[model samples]
Target: MSHYPVHTMATAPEASQPSLHALQSAFGFIPNIAGAMATSPVLSSSLVGLFGNVHGGSFTEPQIQVLLLTNAVTNEAEWAVAFHTTLALQQGLTPADVDAIRSARLPNDPAFAALSRLARTLIEKRGRLDVTDSAAFLQAGFTEEDLLEVIAVTAASTITNYTANVTKPPLEPAFRDHAWHPA
Candidate 1:
């Protein structure tokens, strides 16, 4: 069950938008976390924009998915983990791939593993990257520009994960099977 009551898109249409309705129609239900976002259309749109900026910018889909899952695990945010894991798999990642990313390992590709490690480190260390860290990532084929963009993406998702936790957004029925209440 949700920690708080999530206003559905119907009665609380003011809390949502036409896009939100489209989301509901497309996915069969608006995710409770996303529904909580409906309370502030500006926030919802900004969140969507941030997602688009990060997910659609710089990184490949698999890499972005892994980074999202990594952030959730590092923050111990269950909902973020559940939501992104579902989305990644739906986008064609295997269970093993998800597991690898969650563990900060990438069995299939070393470059991705390097990226995931660097991302997790950046998150855990809170932006104080060491010279050695930078060197290792460089050897792994990442440029300074790539690192900067990755930092931006990481920062954006971190905000969303923390916000969702604070709001205790309802986990959609579609995600019930994967919903986790982090202790």
Candidate 2:
């Protein structure tokens, strides 16, 4: 059983309502992970603020999904894996790219593969990137700022990953088709 209560917008704390509503607006529903996070107004609002910054960062929408999906996969966060798989395809990633991420492999596209590699490395190394690691990401055409932004997106995904692990939210039906498990 889930340790956390999955709050609806109506039942969620007042301070968490806007964040829940924004997630609902963006995704057409309040994800269970967010609902559980809503149990803490601070955690919910902080996630929303961090997500806004991550989305505002220096990458394209599809590229951002690459980073997010990679982090989710690396962290073995099943909920986020399903969610980001859908988002990546919706954002115009090739089906193959999503499949690669679903399989915990680099995306087939060279640029996105580079992104996936860097994201996985960040999590695996706990942000202690070797110089060669950062250089390879830059050599793949991402800027220095983009590397920091990768860290931003990683932070955002890590929150969801940790939340899902703790709360054990059920995956939404809409994302069921894309559900994943880390190999």
Q: Write the residue-wise lDDT of candidate 1 on 56-168 in tens digits.
A: 68788877877777777677677787887787677777788777765656636676677777888898788899999888889988799888888877876776687677777
- Alpha-carbon RMSD of each model: 3.1, 1.1
Question: How close is every model to the real structure, measured as TM-score?
Answer: 0.79, 0.96
Per-residue lDDT tens digits for candidate 2, residues 1-183, read 797899998899999999999889877889999999999999999999998898877788999999988888888889999999989999999998898887878888999999999999999999999999999999999899888888889889999999998898999899999988767
TM-score of 1: 0.79
Error of 1 at 78 (Å): 0.6
Model 2 TM-score, 2 decimals:
0.96
lDDT of each: 0.72, 0.90
Least well predicted 10-residue stretch by lDDT in candidate 2 = 51-60
